[model samples]
Target chain A: MLSIPARRTNDVTPSEITPREVFERRRDFLGTAAGFALGTALAPLSAALASEKPLASIKSPLSTPEKPTPLKDVTSYNNFYEFGTDKADPALHAHTLKTRPWTVSIEGLVKQPKTFAIDDIFRLGALEERIYRLRCVEGWSMVIPWLGLPLATLLKSVEPLGSAKYVEFISAADPKTMPGVNRSVIDWPYLEGLRLDEAMHPLTLLALGLYGEVLPKQNGAPLRLVVPWKYGFKSGKSIVKIRLVEKQPQTAWMKANPREYGFYSNVNPEVDHPRWSQASERRIGEFLKRKTLPFNGYADQVAPLYAGMDLKINF
Target chain B: MAWWFALSQGKRHVGLFKIALFAVCLIPLLRLVWGAWNDTLGANPIEFITRSLGSWALNFLLITLCVTPLRKLTGWNWLLQLRRMLGLYVFFYASLHLSTYLWLDKFFDWQEIVKDIFKRPFITIGMSAFAMLLPLALTSTKGMVRRLGGLHWQRLHRLIYVIAICAVVHYWWLVKLDVSLPAIYSVLLCILLGFRLLWPGQGRRNVISGNFKPAQE
Candidate 1:
């Protein structure tokens, strides 16, 4: 039987939470012995808290029936250019990232502009597991079980001013820590943004962990955003700053190639990228390319957000 | 260098060299098959296959380009004998690369596939390059060479230079950054094409005295 832990509202006691390294070691052990009955029995329960179901009261009707992508593929195949441009570079190079003593600054047009420690953010609301379909702009998709609170919970606490129209997320860019920052792969300190309402969507996640354990550094440790309806790059990783702005802020990819990547990178199959068709995507674990869905199959929920707007122009 | 001399000795040895080159060319495809058999194509097997075949196609193009310059430099006039086979392998790998996209990636959705060819810049360039290669491949046979006559066939085959440029551009535009690999290919192509420009008639003697005589008849 799968055990869905009741959502915890209060601060998690340190003793109850296992260290990331210990959890990873246990996972490696389990993976090696996964062919055995014992490993098979404990596999789903151990890896993720939410096994094919959303947490109680999370209201995730957009979730897919697809099994979550294996932890190996999820961790290994990533496009976090802060580590390197190659998909595997993050997995190899992100270990040097120090995620513990992290803080996020909420500035710009917010009424209560302040920096919050990682712990303080964790204590804002109950952490719940949400299984979401993460679609990349490169025409690949993955089902991920993310552990985090909704972005709305954090935004409400920040108290954005009436003038605030866009919310920008800035990722960490310490060159000493992230070697890829030294290279001119992208403009340093990666930036992503969403409209104020989009940021406040129930599906928008401020993720801190994945697979029941603390997030692997490659998978964006300490803090990240998971905007399920948008392209994966819109979900900035290792986020250090959240700035509420009056106008649409420039995002990293859009700045790099505006024709290819737009500010509103909603997963619309009809709007093809300049380099490739977006009508279909290969799910990471699956062999066949599945037809891509508008808004990554979250259209029923997110389509209203872009109602009457041309997605092709927005994209 | 020693192996080139040994392999270039006589007609029988030249035949042996062609067989050896054929086996050597099959290694990459064989390795891919082995990788598939071992379930080692990584998380996205289709992507792995697609990228591998595309890269092999480009690599073979580079190798095909190298043959003319190598024949000119080495004076191993028999080296010209392998050019047809090397050129054919470029078409082979390129055909596989296109088939991977058409069959495996798109599943023969001709409407979407045709839309992709027309819509995407990279696909447009790649499809054009493949289209150019088709005539060159069709006319590669000895019988067709006789039908077209020598000068016309050579002129027609010169379309390869354009195809090579298109192939490099296809790769360059497709990559999202870190263009070191494509840059290397571009520089190598420049050197090969540049050599041809710098020394126009230098290779004519070698071609006349070499195996190209029989094909001219």
Candidate 2:
């Protein structure tokens, strides 16, 4: 018989090998290949397996055809200023956030304003997987598989008044846990807003998790707002309060620079930011900058919201 | 140790010191290469590489500016020998930075590139700063120095001060907030320029430029 090398005592089991579905995810297999340390923490490997409290969600009919951005990029790279402005800051620092004792309140121009526990929010509607195109104001984009109930479903439960023209989303700001809150980068709590109709749009999502697990803290744990038609920042993370109001609310970015950020911060290839061109955005994990689509390729579905208005002025 | 500091007879040390500084300067590029080879360039590899190269380019520019002040203070005339090479490294890193944006980021989307150059103020200023560096880099050769008169060459190289200032402003405007890093670079650039005004010697060597003792610009 030919000499056969035995399986090494330190070798990984077949089950432990990373799934081949995503190319970047194969780094785990290389960690055992000898020479280089890939710098990925072992803790995240189990996290990616999504064995811990995996919530059930059905695939949504509205999902795009694009392959989801790698989970590592979706988790490791974030724009949550509550943690910090740097892309990696949130992933490094968001462990300090306490998502267990969270409660979100719905009030203002609603007949039945109520504060609900985190669990109660989940009971509001059936969860679904919405693969969305997230275009950031800084000329970057990502396709994320979000697990959440629709914002309209949640808004309907609260019962809004006819006079409620806008819905403001207020993110939780804990200075003791969140380090970025200590900096004067912007006003304390991140405030995001949408028109009442936009809030009730079927495309809008009140996301609670992503990649099939309760959301990673960096990607906005507990709960977050997802408006697929707008810039990524318009989707407020770690929302604590939702208030319905008659007048347009001033969001965090608008307060910081009203000239650059407006109330309706929708994605538009024609409208460029003052500092850089938004005509093209480099997608996460991709080398080439792709041309940005009007309303992030959801113009067919959501463009009706801004029917006659000039997008440049609203941008 | 005593043999190392023989300032009057430092010709033997010049070659070795240049080699040492050149290797030291290449460390940033080496790290970037290692990172790219290992697939450890993080979530957005292109952006990370682009920013890393840009930051190093700025750092090299600042380091090139430091050569004259250090030479004047320490009487390390040998330091001047490394100035041209240090300046050329800035162009090297800058060229890499622009290449990353062009090849990897834009993928030769010349339409978007041209529009960005015209529309974006930061890109406009950054492109201008890089443009100013071309003549200085092209004229760095000993042959070119002799071709242009010493006075004319010195005057042309004064554009470095303006280039450095434009670079720092480009950095300052590119950031959405946290002007702290750019603020530090600005202070350093001011001090570098202010030294010329204060001592009034380490500038374009003209008899009328300063009353102080002779020092090359």
Candidate 3:
């Protein structure tokens, strides 16, 4: 049984997991004991901190040639507002988050609504190594080699209704676990959305891990969306509720400041942020700022989806 | 003669205290240098260095501004001797902050730097504050005070008030969300600057006119 008390009594707990938690803890103890017997005190302690087991994945054709940002740098310099606004806050505070016994409820305008266990989500398809160029609205970029399958795999399982136009992702914002939720920094539960077609794009990833390992707690452990064609925030983190809707879903950033953020936050250097220029972005490891590419260098694959739409107005 | 000269006369430990103060002021820079050498300045080292220098400048500015009040409350008239050094340190840190921006952040891309200065209000305000601090720093010496005259030098240094306001606003505007840290700075600055408004004759004669007489609490 999960000792980390559930937020809601009605939350579905699969019977098999009751023993799994205890087994996991016992295995962890055994692993630590074995590690100590080997006379490597640091091996277990370091592993205990967050070993984030290496996930099973194959080389992906979609992966970019650019060098991936250093794992420590990638994990530490995150902008997940759920934990806090500062880049380093998530790395420090996210350890309190409980990733196991998690379920993502898929409902609304779907023919076969389903509640997916974390295991079920992983079992969808063979995972791939997607090295993506992630451009943030704040003018910083990172090339991340992520481990995951297409988000469309999960979406196809639920089979959306004809009326569905957009897919909304809602992040878990437990005030008890996430201290940042106590503050009135934007609406509590972080929300992000994508056009139904955009959500189904081949480049759009249902990211499970990074650096060939299960994601660090700070990098939205358990699950997160990675929309390479859009601004980094367009990819929601620790997504709990996924909904297919008739109208374009209102995003957290959009609600916070509609004028600055919009429904379509595609990467276009020409359409600058109201406060700052988007022409150039400082790559994480490198000193020189690189010119931001259209659709973050995925324009060939994604631009066709928005051929006629004016990005300037939609942005 | 200034009231400080009479009261501060023959202060036995002031020299040693100044040497200690100078060393204490270098600690922030020392820590940054050590961090750089050790590769522990977080992921974004340049940003960390730039922000650290800016924060130190703001802290030194506030400390410099607080000297008068500290002297009044504690009757440590010798504290006045350290105020000039403290004010100069604000410029030292501010100069490093600007240099980091130009060198590490921008790579001396003057065109882009100019664009940032004009396009970003926060940058504009920050640059203006640094620009104002330059004249005060240059005229800090006794010779410059004599050449410019006491009244003129005092007027020139009064720009610290404006410079401090700009520094706070520059910080407050740049943060994307959670202004609580900057809000704390703003409140402390308000209390420090508020003394002038709340004091007798609005602290003009004793402060603005260089009236160094000890204020009766």
Candidate 4:
């Protein structure tokens, strides 16, 4: 059974799942007392700390009587291509990407510019579990249990100056390291940006891990953004730099094809991608009949932020 | 003396040729399994394994179909000797691809599996192509050939044409954007089929088939 966030009861919610949820759920699936025992033994060190941290609270507009899509479906299929790029090739390719010794550089419109190693950044805020529905521009949706600190917490540390209107995320780009980047498909150093207000949203997360584990390379290990309200690509992976700007920042997909991938890529069915329709999305776990949700069911949590604006024009 | 020697030598090479062909067909399957174990099967191993096997199946099928045309155009009848192995390789990879989907993707839930096969247009075509290839594989042996008889064997093998078309459609529909790769495969298929249509037994039949023996004087 689902409890819909009261603001808008009409939107859809992705099935909620996290890696920690998966470890608990695997007991029945693994079908062995010994397996459960082993999981229990492993849970304290691996699962306890992971489950203890609560992420930003997300409100969904839709409610249903059905159980959310199980954790198994959520973690198995993912689209984080920075680990490796291939619609179907990431799971295998991600294993090879190295996530250690990561450093994130902060530049643009900040009162104090700083570069910090991943470990140093993790020390800034306690982890929280934010379960949000992730909608991909490619018409597939998932409810992810992301384990990370809020974007606001990190932003406050940097102290964006009044002039900072937008914040841009730049992913690491070494063609030799990322084969997909070698090809001029969507531009190397995949870029994404958010308005300062959106960047400061509590729901905006700099996720370091998912499913109760260090982020698998396939799922953007080391670090990635998890902007639940916008399309998943806006949550750029393998992030190396955060740039503040006065005007709207030019994102990669927008620069590559301005008409198709807008910077404000909200999950709107009304605005069809010139190449495909956004009217429907395949829920990652639903076999035959997954339906689409407007704003991925976050209208209650963040929609008011855009209350007076024309969604289509802004979109 | 030459005619007698040619007859004896032709009979001698038949068994060895068949062995060579069988070896060629087994290599790809062995390589795939080996790659899987080694973690060299790419980032999304399951998808990589599935798609690779599917592509190889299609490739082998295309090569098998190309046999008659190549034999007719180049007068290299030995090419026909490899067709059985190539056709079998198609079955080998097609079976692996389907099994991976069943075991890995669907997890062998028969009801849902059947539902997906029926519901998804791409899966429908891909499954149909695989289903059509099964009988051809079942009748691959010399014993089965003898059992089916010459005319029946030829008739059953014609299903490859239908399978080829379905395979191309399966690929074309799956691609999201930049249809170039699928388009390239479709063009190659058209050319292969074109060869069959353009030269339907118009060229030499190769009754001698490289076992040339002058008429005994």
Candidate 5:
């Protein structure tokens, strides 16, 4: 065409001639087609792949690049007693939980008590990614990247009364669905609670997802509490009810064995558990036990919250 | 009656049974080694190995306890021949369990281990039980039995009953909430100890000697 500029040997390639818009449009088409193909290919396993989503972008100074616990370990090694007593039992049994259409009732000592769908809870605030160290009462630890809003944001929306000293979390208890609930390993409708101030702390998270995906069933799908400074058990999973109360709530483990599990359940290295020493903890991916940190190494941020309180007595 | 006499003679097939039992006793350890080699000890290998060894030790203790009652009830007095071997396996497993705690779990941190032994009730009881088991395991040889004399050996071996109790208590105290397994062991122990109370002469007569004879036969 028009002598083709004398067919110069140094001319631009065909890709260079292509318009940027056209290339972008082609990429978009290909992406959609691949997604559709993948969707069809993974149809049978949709339930297993139900919660796979793009990672959230919200950042914090606390977030670490130290590779989070493998998704396999995070999902499999859990202590959700509603499923069973064994650590492996929750992963084995919790998949039966239906997370969609989940609702959490925020009642008691609130000016406006409401039962909000999980989606609505998400809409309440922008979800942020927070990587935190979860130390279990059994002297095991895991680094979890949780995606959620701060608990204070949610509590503030509900408008708590002056009398609300404690916030009690009630987990779901459908025995027909949760096989472990049929057994009396723990009291039904597993209950956990925190002091109102602790509940409202910026570190306290109402977690909706983990590892850049929506929460897996075993890791407490749809909704759970993530208290970075406390023992993992204190962070109740699959929470259905949040009741702001005047009196201290009788937590499940404490009710089960008061001497062994206390109400506060803070991560204190000096305070040995009744049956075993808590001076050291085994991080899940590591071999040698590492010395346990006071307040799980959140002593700088959260220690001031418990300024005068004796951790051993409160623990 | 001739077949029964032949079976209880404690000579024929004794070596074969002893070899088989020896292999069987090593199965747990072999399986644990294989598991460690293959990286199949799950998320917490130390906990898994410790628990497996501890349970095996308790099982052996119960098995050793069962020997007297079984020998008396079945009149297969030759079962006495296996008691020393079974008791020795108990010591083997218990020693391995303790070593896992001391060497592996504590990493030779003697100060912390000692603190744990003193502060933790379960560890304290467990260490006490291991201490009680030491002399019995050492005296398991035929030479030791001959040197100590049968009466003294029997008196020393009576410590097994207390060791059994201590082992069960150690297990019972270690569990967080599910005591079902320990409860089952306790009931079995009760039946074994109760049977001795009901029928007293079984333990006294069944104590084996180096030059053995079937007491009932």
Candidate 6:
């Protein structure tokens, strides 16, 4: 019963970011690169493909250095819904989700709980980009470079009550905007939560961006929680509210089918999903023979948290 | 028609014709395997190929099972001649699909595989379907048909109906979104099954039963 969900951080997301802003950023970036290399020795290829530059190389939406590490297969295949809803079409579909003028409504057991706009929250702490592997409960995993500040530092502002047992997250659920949310596959206003102790964990991040750029829409732009220890879905996407709860909250997936998805959704291969096997997962870009690590190779840091409890029962 | 005539005329190269027909049947399988080798089988190629072959197996099995009912409805018995071959081809592709999952996806991980059989809903249904198909394929030969007798053989073959349902369930569970294809397949299966239910024993059996009253035999 290692509850990794609560250990996730709350991020200060951008209030002014938009899809148009991202597109313009790409245009300006390519424009600047194209300008600098106009008269150099290898200028012929650049000149020939100047007009069709964006089409030439599939540019990663996040920023990379001049000689950045070529991305591995895993993190590149993301499923952050704040960015977009497509399993395969994340970066492209995320363009439709508006991330600006965003406000996170904080309520429940917090001492000074209030609805703060994105700017006010982001101004409280510095954002950092850290790469982490995001493994889904559905048995597919990805590695992503995320930019966000830690949850503990941000929690200082909200001032959690001493009785606060769990912190619950609620994602936006406007069916007109989120077409996928309209479907009844899982309950709308996707909910996930973490224990207070887990939420206070230093590794938990509230992500703002990826690849050194403003967070892409498909990668949960604006704001989303990042719990590196738990399965990816436990880190809820497209968040709109943070309620500090005295009791454990009923989450979206658990509400849909309590028998399959437990609230403490630690990535344990031993406990098979009711509909599929968790014994093995396909690491997004890797070969089939690659053995899925226990707790996704983070057992060293987080395994001690669940020492006395029976995982089988909690699962 | 020409090929049928040639066979009726007792042509010397009738075996060659049968071989060519067999090769023609093999073409779709050939193309699919080629696509797989060329790395063009879409995202998650193994799953795609495995599922494709599995669905085709179910389709061909349903088609084979429909032959007798179809012949009864149309007053034509020639369709029965194609049933055995079609049934065996269905088994062949079903085996291929199962083997692909076992070898490629699971890497023959027996413990995990066993866990999947009981734990996963889709895999549970799929494995049951495959298990039923195994007996059907094993008893397909002429010797087994004679040993089992016609009545027992027909009884044993009715297991295919259960297999068909299980196969459909297996397909429906695997889909992440847009269940339109699975819904269509189920409806098609219903119609196929519905034809048999609506028009059972309507051809030569009716004529014989009419003449003999209680003693049609």
- lDDT of each residue in A150-208, candidate 1, tens digit only: 89988988798999999999999989889999988788789999999999998899987
- Write out fnat for all predictions, comma-separated: 0.52, 0.58, 0.48, 0.00, 0.42, 0.18
Clashing pairs in model 5, backbone N/Cα/C closer than 3 A: none
**Candidate 2, residue B28: lDDT:** 90
Per-residue alpha-carbon lDDT of model 5 for A124-196, expressed as tens digits?
6546678899999988888888888789988999999999999999999998888889888788889999999
For each candidate in turn, the TM-score is 0.84, 0.86, 0.86, 0.58, 0.85, 0.71
Q: After superposition, how far is residue B113 of candidate 5 from its true place, in Å?
A: 2.0
Candidate 5 overall Cα lDDT vs. reference?
0.81
Q: Write the per-residue lDDT of candidate 5 for residues B1-217, one digit (tens) a residue.
A: 9867756675567777788889999999988887776656666667778899999999999898888888778776678788888999999999999988887689899998888889888888899999999999898887887788777777888898898898999999999887888999999999989988889655455554433332221
Across residues B79-160, which tens digit of lDDT does each residue of candidate 1 receive? 7788888889999889988988888788898998888888788999999999999999999988988888776677788899
Q: What lDDT does the true structure give each of the candidates? A: 0.80, 0.82, 0.82, 0.69, 0.81, 0.67
Report the candidate with higher lDDT, 2 versus 6.
2
Estimate candidate 4's alpha-carbon lDDT, on a 0 to 1 scale: 0.69
Can you give the DockQ of every candidate in the order shown? 0.40, 0.38, 0.28, 0.03, 0.22, 0.17
DockQ of 3: 0.28
Error of 5 at A201 (Å): 1.1
Q: Compared with the true structure, what per-residue lDDT tens digits does model 4 show for residues A44-124?
A: 333443464423222221222233434444555666555344564566566666666779999899988889888666655
> CA shift at A62, candidate 6, in angstroms?
20
Tens-place lDDT per residue, model 2, B64-128, is: 99888887887777778888889999999998888877777667879978987998888899999
lDDT of 3 by residue, A43-99 (tens): 433353254556645556677867677777888998987788899999999999999
Candidate 3 structure quality by residue, lDDT tens digits, B67-183: 888777767777878888999999999999999888767779999899989988989999999999999999988778778876677778889999999999999988876799899
- Runs of candidate 1 with Cα error greater than 4 angstroms are A1-63, B1-12, B203-217
Give model 5's DockQ, 2 decimals.
Answer: 0.22
- The CAPRI-style docking tier of model 6 reads incorrect
Stretches of model 6 off by over 4 angstroms after superposition: A1-86, A89-94, A116-124, B1-43, B62-86, B111-124, B139-152, B172-184, B200-217
Task: Show the lowest summed lDDT stretch of 10 residues, model 6 chain A.
Answer: A1-10
DockQ of 4: 0.03
